[model samples]
Target: MKENVQQILAHFHIKQFQHDLIHWFQTEQRDLPWRKDKDPYKIWVSEVMLQQTRVDTVIPYFYHFIEKFPTLDSLAEAEEEEVLKAWEGLGYYSRIRHLHEAVKEVKEKYGGCVPASKEQFSSLKGVGPYTTGAVLSIAYGIPEPAVDGNVMRVLSRIFYITDDIAKGSTRKKFENIVSHIISHDNPSDFNQALMELGALVCTPKNPSCFLCPVQRHCRAFAEGVETELPVKTKGKAPKRVSFRAIVLMNEKGNILIQKRPPRGLLANLWQFPNDEHAPTRNDESFVKEISERYHVVIRSMERIGSFEHVFSHVVWHIEAYKGNALELQMGDETNKWVTIDELKQYAFPVIYQKIWQAYE
Candidate 1:
């Protein structure tokens, strides 16, 4: 079995494959903002934003982010809240937070320059082998492999590797394979070409095998199981969680909002004050709970309806209730009353934005 696997891997013509892929990429690669230059910081930002997001979705966000923070010094010096606001609607708030933190490290420790060596780059927050490989190879011309899901899928089909890709161990195997076949002369174009092939030609479903540059060398194509070659186990379903969200409105029409804790899910973003419990709680109970928790009195309560937001691993089932606050006995440090115009200044997740729109 080992010899057979070795023979299969050895059959691929590395030089020919690299030549065709690079040639095709030069003519066919999309004109992206990040690819305009080899600035390491721009590459880092683009790579981070591209994770779990489509290219079309990221293009506008990329442009906006760069406009706001054009240099490493600009991003590092910016406030966290401003950064979160800039990253609003992008989801996965943690990515922006980590990017901000890493940039700060670069400014303070590395003299406002993105590190060129693998060791320094990997030490930055949220950067892994894939990110490190991408920045190094693409920006610095280092001969390293960036084996993301796209690259894994492409190689798995071409070499007919059936290992379940969900496993961490399987990723290492794919990375090793990429290191072996990556073009030493033009590592940047080589890695991007493989990823582009996976995105455009070797898609997850209904792949356009007829248009593949290396179709003649694909083991899955020869064996008639291209789609089945890249096997991956299904992840567990997201768990459901319920919450009771309270929108406390004063006589002046200012609504109450609270900043989430500085860690965990949706950290430091603003949202309506909420408590986790069964969705069966009535308006009175919700008002009473708010009064007890924050020392505020509600004169009248009305059900505003419900909203659901799904995360990668959890689904939020939120039941919203709006009420007029009759009295404020004590002020909570984390809670604030803001007008509708001021609400726009703080970053709210899409779920909260939808709720606010409904309320308006």
Candidate 2:
């Protein structure tokens, strides 16, 4: 609970910063779809999509998502697979899963309303401190800190905080500072203005200090270290795993695909059957394993291509191969054969889409 919040408040011009930041935001803020209304559902969706994603990238996706599931009830009622299909290219599938789960709980528990209280709202699935703060402040006009990476960076510079942002403990320090200084009259614009400042003017590299509304108030800029204030420790490298994806086709010209396990990474999504092996392993065993496990025989093998898919914590090095299903006794319940056009119906991970691009 300890914070340099008092020191931060004592040093910064809160009143002037609030006036300049909010005035700049009201006039210069981008016409984002989420800002059109105070619907908690829409705000919740946009905030979820914005996490670890760029604003431009999220615009179209936001429009499409709201169109598809315009209401919390609609989203709650949709099938999980169909929801995944709408969110296919967004990467972080878990976000949608958690959002979906929480929305359903909201629909049933809160009578289809997103809770304004921090305790009730944060109790829902995947509703973290950042999300809770954002939805509460933006949707309900609560005076709470939505301290994400952007807010942290902005505050780090303006207050000259030298905490390592990568550390979890650093967030509380920033959050406490935000809680005390957040504008009570216009918490909505205040929070969004801070975020907008970070995204547009106070960029990570070569910040537009001259154009920044609160640049004169920035201690880091005054000290000539705007870019150096938010020190962050680098994360561990993504673990690499190799797989030989076997693409089999029947006489009817259907491709073989299987559903991933219902839990863990890429759960419940369809993908090509992989002959899991090390990168140094020979293709002889790979082909042999595919034939044995899938109950299919192949006369010839053609190396389609080599591809890679990077996730947050792992990198999949995939080597794709193709052949006619010479014989078929397909027995796995999760395995199935579908036409190329029909393949578009089931949700496939971006890596499989890359494999398709290379295959075609």
Candidate 3:
């Protein structure tokens, strides 16, 4: 078995593969700005921003962020609020926080330079095996394989591996194979080519095998099982949460946006204070609870349209209600009332932004 694997590896001609991939990439790869420089900071930022985000979706954000904080020193010196504001539409707020903290740590410890070694890079917050591998390969020319979803799918199809690719063990298996073949010379282009091949030609569904540079070496294509490899595990249903948002507005067009507790969902982000599980219809108990909590005289309540916002693992059924505040009082220190013009001053979750836009 070892000899057979060795024979297969030798036949693939890793250098030729890398050379062909780089040639294809130079001609066909998308013209992204991050690809223009080998700066570790830019590469690190692009890798972090691209997590759970599509390349097209991240382009504008990346350009804007790069323009705002061009260097590692600038990013390290910037305020957390500014960072979060820059990352507003990008979900997974924790990534932004981790990146912000990592910038500070890298600046203080590594003299504002992103670490080049995999071991040292992985020590930073939010830097996992994949991120470390990506940064090391792309920024420092280390022979590390950055196996992500696209790479996994592409590799599975090429090797005709039908095992459930969703398992962590399956990922490790693929990484082992990749680590063996990844070339030390220009591993960055090889890693990027693998990703681009997957994204452009070897797509999950309806892959354009004719356009693939590696089709001749693909075992799955030879076996006519290209679509069947890389079996996926079934996804669990997302948890559903229901909440009522008390949209308090005064005659002055100022809206009441409360800051949630420093932890939990939308932590420290602004939102309209309301009951956790709002009743299906109007209930006196729910109304009373809101009145007591805010300590404000409720003049009248009018129901606004409900909207559903779905996250990766959670779903929120949000019902908006316009409340008339009689006695002007900020109930909680964590909460505050801001004018419509001040909306841009704070970092708000995208779901709330949708509501605010609709309100406006």
For every model in order, what is the number of clashing pairs?
0, 0, 0
Candidate 2 TM-score, true structure as reference: 0.95
Worst 10 residues of 3 by lDDT: 1-10
* Model 3 / residue 329 / CA error / Å: 4.3
Candidate 1, overall lDDT? 0.87
Per-residue CA lDDT of model 3 for 212-246, tens digit only, reads 88887788999999988679998899999887776
Q: Give the per-residue lDDT of model 2 (tens digit) for 179-254.
A: 8789999999999999999999998989999999998889899999997868888899999988888677888888
TM-score of 1: 0.95
Scanning candidate 1 in windows of ten residues, the lowest lDDT window is 1-10
In order, candidate lDDTs are 0.87, 0.88, 0.81
Minimal lDDT window, size 10, model 2 = 273-282
Best by lDDT: 2
Put down candidate 1 lDDT per residue, 174-235, tens digits, no spaces.
88888888899999999999999999999999999998898988989999999796889999
The C-alpha stretches of model 3 lying farther than 4 A from their native spots are: 1-11, 251-253, 277-283, 327-333
Task: Give the runs in model 1 whose Cα sits over 4 Å from its true position.
Answer: 1-8, 277-280, 327-333
Model 1 deviation from the true structure expressed as Cα RMSD, one decimal place: 1.8
